[model samples]
Every structure is written in C-alpha cells, then in structure tokens.
Target chain A: MKRVEGLTHSYRFSWFALILAALGSGVLLLIVAPLAALVLSTSFGELSQAAADAQVIQSIRLTLSAALTATLISTVAGIPLSYVLARKEFFGKTALLAIIDLPIIIPHSAAGIALLTVIGRRSLLGSVTGGLMGSAAGIAVAMAFVSVPFLINAARAGFLAVPERLEKVGRSLGASPWRVFFTVSLPMAWRDIVSGMILMWARGISEFGAVIIIAYHPMTTPVMVFQRFNDYGLAYARSVAVLLIIICVAIFVVVRFLARPTQEAQDA
Target chain B: MLELRSLSKQLGLFTIADLNLRLNHGEYFVLLGPSGVGKTVLIEMVAGFITPDAGRILCEGQDITNSPPEARDFAVVYQDYALFPHLAVAANIAYGLRARGVQSKQAAARVRALAEKLNIAALLNRRVGGLSGGEQQRVALARALAPRPRLLLLDEPLAAVDIGLRARLRHELRCIHQQTGTTFLHVTHDPDDALYLADRVGVMLEGSIRQVATPQELFRAPSDAAVAEFLGMRNIMTVDSASEGVCQVGRVEIHAALADESTSYVWIKPEEILLSRQPFDSSARNQFRCVVAGWENSGPLLAVRISSGDLTLTALVTYESFSELGIDAGTELYCTFKSSAVHCF
Candidate 1:
C-alpha cells in the first residue's frame, strides 16, 4: 500500500513541480530581461563616465538623501498610525484606510498637484512654514507623499499579524500601554516595518513626476535621467539609469544581507 | 480576595446581566461553561480589559472597577499561551518582572527560579517559537507568575494542550496554586479542568453563572437542568409528580430521598447504579427488572443502557461484570440504586 501511494504521489508531484517552475521562471524572466538589457546596453567606460560626472553624482546623492529623510520621517509618524489602524476600530477607519491608499491609486502627477496645494507657496501650510518650493524639504515631501502607503500598509499588516491576546497579556503582566507597544508589539513587527521602509525608500529614489513639479532644481536621479534624455540623447540617459540601477541594487543587496540572519534564526 | 457586585455588560447580542461572584483568597476557582458563553469576557472584565457597564470590582476590599489592566495587577494566561515569539523563554518569563521595574539581576534570578519551579529550566535559553505546546504553557505560566499578581486569570489554559498531557498539566496547576496561594480564576469549557483543579467550580450557562459549588457537590447536586446537562449528567428524567420521598418518571415510580413538592426533575449518577443478571437482594430503595437496551465502551466502564417499563436509565458497569453477565441487546438485567443516590431539582 505504501509503495503504491508513493508512486502516485511522485507522479502527481512531478507534474505540479513542472508547472510551478514554468510559472516562476516566467515572472523571473519578465523582471530580469529589461533590467539586463538596460545594463548591457551601457559599456563599462560609459558607466564610469556617468559615475564620474559631477552633475550625475550630485543628483544621485540628493536622491539618496531625500529618500532617506522622507523614509525616516514617514517611519517615525506612520508606525503609530499603522498600529492604530491595525488594532483599533473607530469611526472613519475605512475612510482613513482609503485615504492612506489614495497616493497609490491616483496618478503621480495629480498627487504632486495635491501636495503643492497643501504645502507649496501661498498655501496655508506653506505660509506657516515659509514655503517648501524649490527646496530639499519640498523634494522629501513629494517623495513621502507618493511612497508612504507602502510603509503604512506593510507595517499595518505586520501589526495585524501579531495576536491581540499577546498585547492584552502584556498589559496584564503590569506593563503600561506604552511599555507594551515598545517591548511587545514593536519588536514583533520590526521586520515587516523595516522591509516596508526599504520599499518606501526605493520608491522615493525613483520618484520623478512629483519631484519634478515640487523641487526640480535639487534633481533626484529619475528627474536627472529625464532631463538628460531631453537635453542630450538616449545614450547619456541610459548610462545614468544604469548607474542608478547598480547603486540601488547594491544597497538593496547589502540591506537584505544585514536583515537575513535574524530572519533565518527566527525561521529555524 | 475578589468580589464582583451586580456586574453587568452588554456586548452586542450577548448580555452578562447583574452577575455576582466572590473569590476567597488562595482558592482555586474554575469557571466551567460551553464555548461562546462569555466566560472570557467576564475574566477580561476582572482583568480590567473590559469595563463592566455597572458594577464594583473590589479586590481585597479596594474598589478597582475602572482600573487599567496594568494597574489592576491581574495577570492573564491566555488560551493560546501567547508567548512572545521575539523573545527567548527566559526573556518571556522575565517580561512581567521587567515591566514592574525589577532590577536585571533580580529579574534574572526570578526567571531562573520560575523556570526551575515549572521544570522548564532547560528551555529558558531557547526561542519560544520552537517550543512545544506544553513548554509554551509552562513559559506562559512562569511569565504570569513572575510579578506575583494578586489574581491569575487563566482563559482555557489546558484547551490547546494535547489530551495525553492535560492530566499532568492539571496536576501541575493544582500544585502551583497550592505553592503560590494566589487566587486563581480559570475559565474552561473542559469539565476535567474544573473537576481536577477547582477548589470551587462555577457553572456558567449563556452569560450568567448558574451555580457555584465544590467539585463533589457540583457532581452530586446541580442547581438546574442546564447545569446538570453541562456537567454530562445524561440520566436526568422529568418528574411528572412527586409525593413524600417518591417521584414519577414517566410511568415508573422511583424513590428518591430528596424529592419534594417543587422537584421538577430527578437525576441519577450513572456510576452509582449497580447492574446484576439475577435479582440480588440489596438495601437499595429502587430496584427494577430492566432489559439491556444498548452498551457503549467507555474506557474501563461499559455504559449499559437499561429500560424498565417506560423509564430508561444509564448505568456504568465494569467491563469484568458486563462480560460476566454476558449482557447484550435484549438481555434481562436487574439494576438497583439507593434512594440516597438520586438527586432531584
């Protein structure tokens, strides 16, 4: 009986495995093919030239710094909001969730217009803060405006995965509400929150339409690529894109390497 | 000591209305109920997670109706154990102590002491995610006990444990209650938890506590039909009429010492009845020539259903006697029980 069952199981497994591999490799090819073509189109000399160009270097730096600042600010503010959304059921919760997802749903250029209405020059918030137009602060705001949903949604999912009973138990053990949040809830959800921040930072680095409208002078890498494509040609633009992609990929790999050990230990 | 005075709460369609209970200090009290009976909600209220709509929660004569869960100092061990996956077993145990601002050295010492007491010393350095259910339970217990809370509320602590380990865990819980002398308010749907671990058992039906008594008293005498049925008393028969010390069950008249004018039903403990092939003379007030209707294997005891006239009674006979009598369907048997064994309510 066992031998017969094993034969049937292996027969079914082979077919399932073949289909799974085919579907998985299809996705892999779709993602990798364009990136590989883009990278291969630019020679090593051209990549080095773009890396050495002071304008390209400045834009990359500005992009990284602005994205990092936006991510840090969003993380500080979004975590609490995410936790609340995950744990609490209040009036307007669905509306609040929809509002959080608005940036993702709307066009990036329209999102830029909305941010300008809120914090650009002559707006109430802008007048209060002495305006953020054509400034690094404006660039960070545009990046944050377009990319914050990823962080909020991921953190919310993480917080939601944590059992409410654990928090209740933590409180019953004499921990204050704040203590429970920091010691129990925050630690449990840290991995998802960190990954969310990474995604937000990556999205912010590649932001173009919103940043172009808000602060084009302190150009991010994506805006610089567009500017160079219009002013110069496709070859120059492609080299800079290659440089940005390499830097982003390198940073992503390093971050993933740093995060892998704790995840592996937990899984083991 | 803890006291709940006319506690009431409206949670959607379920209403815990004007409920009252008092727990003596150092007593192991178990609340037995069916699932969705608002048992967890009641304890959560006592733990200060849910505020009672109108009630006074007095702990050792101090009112704490509105205290936060932390301020109430009542630790809860949830059904799932809910051990922190991010922490090691030792860290999990030390959580309460750290929350109470205990010094690190002292907290570590306390954690070690709890681990030793719970026989989980070896697992202290291991992560909680990989621990078995039993190990997680011990760790949760250690964590709840670390700060020495005045009351420990256990919400179905044994429900998730394997059946083979439940008995041992129940014994351990009894021992821990004795050693700590903390008022334990354990809620569970499993009757074994109440029978084995409770100093006093409260039977909850719907949202209200129907009766509270010692384990023996609860088994021997339940206050209502709901409570009796909840305790697995399957031989309850409606009393058509009662006079003096006798009650009419269908067309059969049975002698019960406790049957009164207001007695609506009479319940006989299955184990208390004796089954014999021949009519053996006994001092029992109730004796009937019954036919063996059906039999079911119930561990060491054979649950033999006997029908006498229109009345049917369940009797638990040892496997030895059952096979000796060679009883089967339609086999003639004489079942006997004393009037003292019958309880009417």
Candidate 2:
C-alpha cells in the first residue's frame, strides 16, 4: 500500500493514525453525547405532543421561512460583494473584509443591539421599513446580520478559486461584462454560492440571542426553545431542540447531495 | 487587418512602451519572445482588456482604441485554454454565438461545425472540466472561432499542451487559419512555432517589438543582436580590426562584400558554420582551424563547440558527418563559412 502524505507507516498502521483516532474519539464524544442525550431524553409521545403544539409549528415555520428569506436576500446582494472582493484590488480591501466579519467576532447580543441602533423604531431606517422591532423583517434583519459573513466568505472563496482567465476568455468571446457574470462566473461558482447559502440558512435558523432581542414575540424555533426552557424547564426545551436538529440535518444532507463538485475541487 | 501604433502601458515593475505592430488580412503574425517579455500585455491591450496609455489600436482601418472588448469584435484563446467548467463542450463553443443574439439552432450548428473542424465533435457533449489539456485547447479554439470575429489573438495557446502533441497541433492551427481566412496574432516563445506558422514573425523583448519580418528573412537576416540571439544564433563575435571590405572576427579574418561598417556586433547562425576534416577550396571567405572542445547530441545533429586559440564558436554537424569524421573532444577540425552569413547590428 502507498503511504499518504503527513502519515508515517509501520507494520500495518501508523502511530500518527492510532494516536489521532484515540484523541479524536474524545472530542467526538464531547460533541455527539449532548445531541444523542437530547434525542434519547425525549419520548415519542412528548415529541409528537411538541410537534402538535400550534406555537411550536408556527415557530418552526417562521424559523425556516425567515432563514430562507435572509439567505435569498444575502444571495442576491452578497454574491456581488463577494465577486468584487475576490476579483478587485482596492484601498481598504482588508478593512472591508474585517468589517464583514465583525458580526461573527462580536457577541451575538451585542450584534443585535447594533442592528437595533440602525433599524430601531426611532432611527431613519426603522421608519423606512415601517419599524423593524418585533416584526418578521426584524427577525430576518437580525438573521442576515449574524449569518451574511458566512455567505460572503464562502462565495468569495468560490469566486477566487475560479480562474480569472475564464472571465477574460468570455469577454474576448464578445460577452458583455454583465452577460459574462451571469453566464460564466455565476454558473462556475454556483456550487460554492449554494454551499454558502446553505451555511447562512443553517446559521440563521439556529440564531437565538440576536433574533430574541430583535423580535421575541414572533419567536423563531431557537427562540421558542428558549421560551419553553424558561417557562416549563429543560424537558420541553430538549424535545423542541431534538425535533429542530432532525429537520436541519435532513435539509443539510439533501442540499449537500444536490450540490455538484466545484471546478477547483474537481481539478484537485 | 489590425494595427497597434505606439502603444504604451506602465504596469507596476514592467512597462510596454511605444510598441507598434501590424497584421495583414488573413495573415498569421506571430509575436515571438521569451516568457515575461510582456507579450501578454500587448495582446491584452489589443483585446481591449488593457487600455494603452499612449497609443491607438486600429482594426480594418477603424480607430478602436477606446472600444470595449466585446465591441472590439476580436476573440482570444488563453494559455490555459480556459474552457467554462459549468458548460459542456458544445455549450462552451456556442457561448459567443449566444452572446451575439444568434438563434439557438444557428448557434448549435456553428458549434457543431467548429467542433468538427477542430476534431472535437465526439467530445462536444462532455463537460469541459473533464477534458485533457489538448482537448480543452481545441474546445477553447472552437469557442473562439464560433463567432468568426474579424481577428483572433492566441496567447501562448500551446504553452500548456503536451510537448509531444505540439507539432501536430501546430500544423492543424496553420490548416485552420487557411480554412477560416481570419487574421491571427499568436504570441509564443518557441521559435519553431513562429517558423512553422507565421506569415510574419515579430520578435519582442523588454516590452518592445525588436524586429518583424517573414520567417525566412527574419531567420536569415535578423535586424539586431536581440533578434539574432532570439533566433538561436550563438556565434556572435566582436570586431578586433577593420579594413575596406574585411573585418577581423575571433581568430579569423572575415572578407564580406556585403558587411556593414560602424557595427560592433557580429553574429552567424550555428547551422551556417560548415565543419570539414581538411582545408577545402570553396568560395567562402572565412576558414580556420579549431579543436572540438565539447559536443552535445541535438536530435539527428550534434552541437559541437570548437575553439581556435582565444575564439570559441558552435557548429551543428549531422550524426553521419560526426561519425565519418570520427569527431570527438580535442579533435582538430577546419570550420568554413561565408562571411556574408555574418549578420551585423
């Protein structure tokens, strides 16, 4: 058998592999135990009851739809930003990238407060949006605020991986700039863009601190889980959490299966 | 027909200054240079990707220096053969047609015709990402020709293809040019490519066109030292003395009725130097005794490096000649050549 890079071989298995396996299992258990325990703690009866609750169903629908909305809006706006960031060189590019990442680095509650200051009822933007507080739009704004960086970064990487020569070839083939973007750049980078959208959507659906502060009344699934935990204790929250995990996992798997390999990945 | 007049660009650390070149209709004009000579910048400038700071571009007698790439109506094949990974071969070829508002059926027909001409018809339905380097090159060529632009620019198109396939592709490119009758401006570093494909060959160095001529003229009569060296001439000698129609070069006196005066650089092509075992009568003006200091196999020929006293020169000898003369290192030989073969600049 051939030896892989970064792996040292002995009789059958390498010492590096053996140690990695042993050490990785500990971290794996630390993450998987909590999720497994949550699922195990919830009975089928409790899960069905939680699923049947009107507030639970409403929050689930609200969460998925808000996430979808935020992802769609980000896809439309973030793709251009990512494409420019990937292809253009300008003063303050690094600073712009850092600013895009500010929401992720800052505490989620702090991020929510920042959004409120911009789009709250008393502000100019709040009036323009008919006041964002406690509205579905507020929830989306909060979700987008915390999740857009993931989309931008992923899409930027995708665009960067695409050879600039391809775009030039398109131009030389008599394609207008906009036409080239739509026909060549977008399709070539779609796999990464789709992956980015999925990541943003997943992150948005799970958002709690930001969404709760912006729109607590119209609770998303995560916010509802928190409400259930605060009002009825751990048991109700655990069941809701288990159900949400199953839904998110199913969607994630389906999306991943549908995505074709990117050009860079295929070349590698 | 295309012309670039006094074009200039200052791209950090490199500059292309006052570069001028012209292409006749249906001509294969090759800009041959070593890598990093800013050949790409010149091509991009003509393609309208890089606007020249100080010159005008003319195509078919129209001044189009400020036109965008799409409006320029010129196609290009990049070095990497940048086929669209998202599209199949047919779709990639059809892209230019679709962009120009050609009907779908017409575009498909054009795509199929180009694919067949490029011998890529069987691979038309396959995704471009899965193609080999040569196949991708053909797909890119097909795409560039699908629109039938007035001129085509190829930037080191064979630079990424397999070496073994290059000679055959070179022949195919010449055939394609004849069949299409489109003007082509191909940039490459390979002298063989220029000699084989160009109707006119231009040597570029340091961001400027050093010389341009028909392949035969350029090979036999390079206008400058750079052009001569670029054309693979290695027997460059300095003048030690001068007379009415004679100049002392290396250890031998050269008699040339056509030699230029007021010249410091003298060059002779390596293949032009004749190697003989004994002094023979010939009309050649320069003949001298030299010892073979070293030899290297160059396909069917051997590149022999010889030195007479302080002067060293390289000469090409066929394997048969090398064997018949029993030539090896330290062997004495007589090298003869017409001094008219010496190009002065």
Candidate 3:
C-alpha cells in the first residue's frame, strides 16, 4: 500500500520537484562560490604567514573586542528605550520610531561624519567625551552609531511580543513598575533581545566605511585589510578577509547552536 | 471594606459614569456584565491601575483612588491567567512574595504550601507553557493567593477552563475565599459563575450599575426592563394603570403585591409561572388562561411558552407533568403564579 501511494505521489511530482531543488541549490552556489574560491585561492603557507603576523593578530583582537564593547553599550542603553517605544504612546511617537530607524538607512560615511561633528573636540559633546577622534573609543562610537538600530528595533519587537496583561498581573501582585520590568518583561523578551545583540555585534565588527572614516589610525581588522591590499596586492587582502570570515562564521555558529529554540513545549 | 464613589471615566464613546458601589469586608461581590460592557475597565480602576477621571476609591474607610496598583495590596487573576511564560510554576506562584522582599527559603516554603493547597505541587517545577488550561488557572490562583492579599479581583477566571473543570475550579475558588477570608470582587459574564460564587451581585450594563442584590433577588426581582431583559426575563409589559395592589398590563389585570401609583412596569419570570390543564385552588393570586405558544426541552424540564391576548408568558414544567397533562403546542392551558412573584418597577 505504501509503495503504491509513493508511486502515485512521485509520478505527479518527481521532475518538477527536481527542478525546484536545483533552483535552490543554484542560489546557494551563487552565495557560496566566491567565499569558497577566496579560501581555495589562498595557499596554506600564505594563510599561515597572515596568521603569524603580529599586526594581523592584534587587529583581529581589537576588532572583536571593540565590537563586543559597542554591543554591550547598546544593550545597556537601548533596552529601556526599546521598552518605552514598545509600550508608551505620546506626542511624536511615529516620528521617534522613524528617527530610531534612520541610522540603518543613512550612508555609513555620512553616519561617520555625523558622529565626528558631535565628538570631534570642537563640539560640546566632543569636549565631554575627551575628543574621541581617531581613537579606539571613536571606532566603537562609529560602529555603535551604524549598528544600534538593529539592537533597538529587535529588542522593541521582542518587548512588543510580551502581552500587556502579563505586565499588569505583575503590578497587581504588589510589584513596583521597575520590578515588573526586571522580572516579567525583560525575561520574557530575552531570546529576541539576545539575538539582536548578536546581530548588532556582527554588524559592528564588519563596519569598514564608518570606522575607517572616523578612526582610521586605530587600524581595526577591516582597515588593516584595506591597507594590506593597497600596500601589497589581492593575495594579501584575500587571506585576511578569509580569516575574518572564518572567525565570524565560527562565533555565529556557536551563538546559533545556543539560541536555537529548545524542543521543550513552552508555556501558554 | 471597599467603596467606589462616583467612579467615572470616558473611554472613547463608552463611558463608566457615576458608578457607586460598596462591598463589606469578606464579601464575595460579582460585577456581572456582557463582554465589552467595561467590566474589566472597572476592575482595573479598583486595582488602581488606571486613575479615574472623577471618583474616590475607599479601602478600609480611607481614600486610595490615586494609589498605584502596587500599593493597593490587591491581587488579580486575569481571564487569560497571564502566567509568565519564562518562569516555572513555582517561580510564577512565588513572584509576588519575592517582589515584596520575602526571603528565599521563606518564599519557597510558602510557594510549596500554596501549591499543595491548589493541588499543583507536582507541577511546581514545570514550565507554564507546557501546562493545560486548567493547570494554568490553578497556578494563577496560587500566585494571586500566595501573598494573602487584602483584596482579590478575578476577571472571568474560568473563561479558559473547560466545562468539565469549571465547576470543580469554582468550588475550589469558594473554598479558597473562605479559607483566606479576603474580600473577592469577581467580574464575569457567565451567569453560572456569578450564581455559584457571589454573595452579592451587581448587574452592570453600558458602564453603569443597574442593580445590586443576591443572585436569587437579582433573578427574581430585577429593577427595570433593561435588567429583566439582561437576565432573560420575557413576561414584561408596561402598566397602563396602577391602583391599590393591581396593575393593568396589556389588557390583563396582574395582581402585583408591590404595585403602586408610581410603578410603570411589571416583570414576571418563567420558572415562577406554573402550567396546568385546569385551574386549581392555590394561594397564588394571579391566574391567566393562556395558549401553549411553544415548548422547549431544557434537560429534565420543559420551558412552555404561553400567550394570553397580547402578552407572552413562559412557564416551566417537569417532564412528568408535561406527559401527565398531555401538553403540546396549540393546547389551551392555565398559567398560575403568585402576586408576590410579579415584580413592579
């Protein structure tokens, strides 16, 4: 009986199904071919040489740490703002939402310039921040400026998913508003907020245009790649690019392994 | 004791205007209304979540209308239960205690004790998302009752529980209310929920309290036509004339014991009307000759709809009586009722 059913199903679908699967594979190859070729083109000896270089290692460390710092700062400051945007309605709420989304749409170089005007020693905020131009702090500031929208928007969507009734129950149970936020809203939004943090961090580390414009002297990994390509050639930059991609892929795989929704049934 | 005096708010076209009510300490009061009649809004107001546009809420004879919900010493169980999805059953139950600075060991002990009482001890470590509707409701009750709150508010608590478990949960709620001795103000749209649990019920419609009485009183003697219509009363008519203890309604004179010159309407319930093949002697003063307009089986009994002149009256009869009298639609019958059963308003 099963064999008969299978024959009837595949007779109707076999060729069409094969062609559909081939189309999907073609798209996958379109994305995978360049990265595979980039890695394959670099001889192992060359990869080792790039790996051994002290400057390359230091730049990698600097990039990862700065990205993490930027992500941390965004989370601490953005979660509350995200919650407010999710729950409250007042004057100019739509305008505020649009403004929060502006960083993601504006050109990275323009974003770098905007950051500079506010933190370039000549401006009031620049003096307050001790003139962060061409410094690691400036690099982090540029990266955060370009990437914070991802964190805020993701966290806001997470907060919006938590029902208002849950929060009201918390308050009715003799919990203060602050307690309700900490215990009820924040924990419920944890998964989305954490994923957003990871995305923001990944986006921050890849920031070449904005960081190079704002703080080139610090020589983050992306800036170093550009410099190596200019001084030497394609062979030099390709290896570093491959190394950065490997590190990003490794970290993201671990994060995804941790974040995949558990099979356990969730509460209503 | 709790009192709401002139509680008023405008929610975009629907208005809760001048709602005044009082509940004695330890009273189980129900605010009954249909869905979207602003029942939940009133519960929120009493819980101090929303500040009323005009009113004063008094608890223990002190005004607390402006107090925040946290300071009100009240607990609420929502229709959806709203158990924290991230927390385990024990943690959800212990949340109120922990928020109030209860010690870890003490809170854990109290959570366990409450879980035991609610028959959910085995589920203390289970995640809320994995529980069934009945289990979630039990957890919600345990959570709200853990802190021994001064006042408990229930918003259609049995809405999510299945029919099989509703009666059991309702009995448990009554037991819990007695054990805790806390004032309970439960709001529900279910007639059975109110009748089973409420010591006194306030019928609310269009954001106003129409009448406040016991379940029997509210069913037997509703104050107005609207209340009668809401409670499923059908034998209502305008009184053309009212004199000493008698009112002429739709060309039939109904002997209403409470009738006076001021009365303008009369309400008669279906269960109070008796059906028979012939008129017999009885203390019931009001009797009418009616035709069997319709008959419907309501489980063990039958609801017989009878029409007399222009007035329609519903009378209920047992299955035995229905068979003994050979009653059916289009049969002539005599409907008898007490004059006291005729409510005049």
Candidate with the greatest lDDT versus the true structure: 1
What's the distance in Å from true for residue B52, model 3?
0.1
What would the per-residue lDDT of candidate 3 be over residues B1-345, giving only the tens digit for each residue? 999999999877668999999999999998888888988889999998788999899999989999999988999999889988888899999999998999989999999998888899999998887788788888999999999998999999988778889998899889988988889999988878778899999999999999999998887667888887877666788889998799998788999999999888888777899888899999999888889988998877798888998778777789888899888889998989999998887
Q: Model 2, B154: alpha-carbon shift in Å?
A: 0.9
Compose the digit string of candidate 2's lDDT tens values, residues A65-142: 999999998899889999999999999999999999998899999999988999999889987877799989899999
**Per-residue lDDT of model 1, residues B1-345, tens digit only:** 999999999988668888889999889999999998889889899999998899789999999999899999899999889888888899989999999999999999999998998999999899877888788888999999999999999999898878888888888888999989999999999888888899999998878889999999998778877888988887898889998899988889999998888888888889999988788777899999999999999888999999999888899989889889999999998989999998887
Q: Report the number of the highest-DockQ candidate.
A: 1
DockQ for all models, in order? 0.57, 0.54, 0.54
Fnat by candidate, in order? 0.82, 0.77, 0.84
Worst 10 residues of 3 chain A by lDDT: A259-268
lDDT of 3 at A249: 94
Interface RMSD per candidate: 2.0, 2.1, 1.8
- Computed on C-alpha atoms, the DockQ of candidate 1 is 0.57
For residue A83, what is the lDDT in candidate 3? 97
